[model samples]
Target: MPAAGSGLYVGLMSGTSLDGIDAVLVDFSSGTPRLAASHHVPFADPVRAEALALCAPGADEIDRAARLSNALAQLYAEAVAATLARAGVPAAEVEAIGCHGQTVRHRPDAGYSVQLVNAALLAELAGVRVVADFRSRDLAAGGQGAPLVPAFHAAVFRDAREHRVVVNLGGIANVTDLPPLGTVRGFDTGPANILLDAWAARHLGEPFDRAGRWAASGSADEPLLCEMLADPYFAARPPKSTGRERFDLAWLERHGVATRRPQDVQATLAELTARTVAEAIARECPGAAAVCVCGGGARNDDLMARLARLAAPVKVTSTAALGVDPEWVEAMAFAWLARQALLGRPGNLPEATGARGPRVLGAIYPA
Candidate 1:
């Protein structure tokens, strides 16, 4: 692998949504990092099913998880090769590949967050150095071990003249507060696409509610929305993170969501995401002038419209306005994290993760 400061790096990310992997080749030769190429590999149905099944404990977990880990590494390797080919960059020139792996479980409160990737296999298959397991070090330092992207957001999105908040709407939603001047802070706001997509797949027979159209077609159940808002996770103070472990289909059912109209439940879910995110911003990021949104939720017109209404007086826009494509920001952040790891730099912001202090994240596997 080449030295850290100036070379190509590939970032691979597969979030809690069970969405496919996203890969991006980033160029850091210039003072500013630039996206050289991007590619996505959707998960095959069986793979997605197995991953979702592993999120919760099941029979034969030990054997199942090991097999799945190897499968994910192969998928990650393919993503790296395709991304490198798209960028026309040779594997040898790349400093390293940062793979966030597939998170089957994230229990930071228990001092661990499991992201399954056979880093050694990925390095051998992709023919490049690999950085994986980025969260373990933070957890070891008494931190939540999540919302690690805030460090990257602060590095790339902070502006001296204005206070900005970057919200990433993946399976779960997280907010990063970038003040014109202050310690950067971030945490999971609540569920984003995870529930919405699952509900859509159940009712609409689709992977997701594209543009949240089905949600727009129905009215939000005020009582249900209020009931969901009362969940302690939404009200919990920062230095926190959550995943499917807390908010999933079972969670919706426990709230008697089945009694409500499917479309109404979908609408309520969308409202839930919008309200939690807007409220988080209102509470933690007061005086912020703009909210830059990224990730799959940014593409949902219904969710965006609801957020825009709730976040009035504050401009709501995609990261594209800030010169980063919303869909690719997380993947790019991992690439940046790999560079940080290679340089022996701390990647987690202590304020964001509530760690003992700064920590150099991820373990490297040689090519």
Candidate 2:
């Protein structure tokens, strides 16, 4: 048998933000996760548009989805090849790849969360083993089947004597509270960058507001912010998760965001993100020693400032301080999950995902 923590795995993640692909070549041989090599592949404008279209009802969705899956697989294979080449590691020398495909539809309450990618196609193209469909087993066992990274967070960022929190500011933000005792807890905090991106795209013609500059240029509309905070999703109890289904453009139009001045709406949207995330941390992990954020949103200086201000005195910083860059944590988590599957170990946290118990996640395809 191959030695544990003596192998390399590549992790692929394209989050709900529909931004791009993040592929990381992670080495576990050192007994601690290290980024050997990494590369990001942005989706073409047309590809990103189609991905957004699939989030809602659209024409030729079935055929488009099937085509998109294959296209994504091809892109995924290229990414794998690029990362391995960058690391100077051949495909045969690598172990397996853990892939978190693009999440267009996540409906845990309905007992299904779809992450679109073809593992067989990827395996065939990359000529390496693949592990995917990580959410299904936990969903089958009666769980939220999300915020899956807490287990990985606990493994890497947890302190034996001190409490810590890891907040992922993805399309939708989620937080993992690692206390010194008891079970680890995590859940979706609500919209983070998705709305910010959507609003930015509409008014600024950009995929996202760079560093949230546009929002920082305008003041948040207080009434609208209050109305948005009143959303039941915010006050809902834990063991929860959400995605494009709950907070998409339709959700925004219904909230009368269109009628408001565009810049103010953008400001309110950014404020909405910061407030929901900060309040969640304050409420869920009051005594957390520090809140380390990781994700695309972490790079937004204005959003980070808001998070720091709202979660003040509790300490807020990026995962960089913890020896990991903010943007790659999710991808790295999937790499660790892939390792767990290959080792026949459990990857989901029961308390975090509301699973029946610890269960080995993901399906594996041999090379």
Candidate 3:
């Protein structure tokens, strides 16, 4: 059990989409963390431009990374304040803040995963101990250092009688399979909104295709989807991880779809995501009772439809049905991770992330 009077904590996360920061206020006590409130703060145009620019492969990457880190830290601090203000909580009442930071590149196989964050600045601005850099230690330990949320998912969403697969379709789609009574397994299935968003922004002049209406309006190009699936990443065994580096715009262009219509490409990308995710689940946990979709992809009706069709025999539903809002699931996972860090608990499951062994994750920066 946690010591008495261990105050509250706030967790901040910015995913691959470069969309915004998600902050959640959590109360940690007696070994469990409960969500108190959550907030989403969209990125300003200049900040977004800077962040996107930093993702390029070129010189001065490290220098640009440093600048972006401090900028993102300020944004995280602001998000924390906003969340606390809306929750009617005082900063002094909080114990710490957990920030996942912005992932510019995640290559655990190379023994490091970079998540740009300024912990010192976050601590100074938030006036609380900040736990950040959660994935490096696991990678250093020869693990994929990803899908870290499965441990938290097992803790919060596991059911005693039914086996469940929790699929988080953020920029990259990942699924965590939790059986009624056994070890859980998880991995990045493939591209999710990243490709679709990029395609939409390029062709439709929008950040994302709302409700996947654009995709639904077009038809999937089966040849393009097949070419995409041929990428060895999908066929490789579990405990793997990927980012925009592998499945971004360049990758789409290389897959023989240059002349295809934008909506058709979106449709094919959405299908690829759904098919890869379902294939992973079918290969890993064929008996999964239902697939619970989460992350931003849950809002895409066309993606959901494709997932439903791909799932076929398996039913599909959102994490909301299991008491977790799809939008806040990742943020909540980080909050739970912070709680685990405080308890000196193992946050990564070896079976899920292919770690050498169970290990406690994250570094703590004092307030």
Alpha carbon lDDT of each predicted model? 0.93, 0.90, 0.86
Model with the higher TM-score, candidate 2 or 3:
2
Q: How many clashing pairs does model 3 include? A: 0
**Alpha-carbon TM-score of each model against the true structure:** 0.99, 0.97, 0.96
Worst 10 residues of 1 by lDDT: 1-10
What value of lDDT does candidate 3 attain over all alpha carbons? 0.86
Which RMSD values do the candidates have, in order?
A: 0.9, 1.5, 1.9
Q: After superposition, how far is residue 36 of candidate 3 from its true place, in Å?
A: 1.5
TM value for model 2: 0.97
lDDT of 3 by residue, 1-367 (tens): 2233655778788999888999998776645566789999999989887877767677788878999899999889999999999899888787778789998887776778788989999999988778888898788778888989899888878899888999999988889999998778888988889999999998988889999999999899988888888999999989888897787888988986778987788888888999999999999887899999999999999999999998978999999898768898898788778767877998898887888898889998877
Candidate 3 segments whose C-alpha is farther than 4 A from its true place:
1-7, 30-33
Query: Candidate 2, residues 1-367: lDDT per residue as tens digits?
Result: 2233457999999999999999998998876899899999999998898888888878887888888989999999999999989989888877899999877689898999888898899999999889999999999999999989999999899988878899999899999999988779999999999999998988999999999899999889999899989999999878899999989887888888878889889889988998998898888886887999999999899999988988888788999999998989999999999999988999999888999999999999888
User: How close to the true structure is residue 286 of candidate 3, measured as C-alpha lDDT?
Assistant: 70
Arranged by lDDT, best first = 1, 2, 3
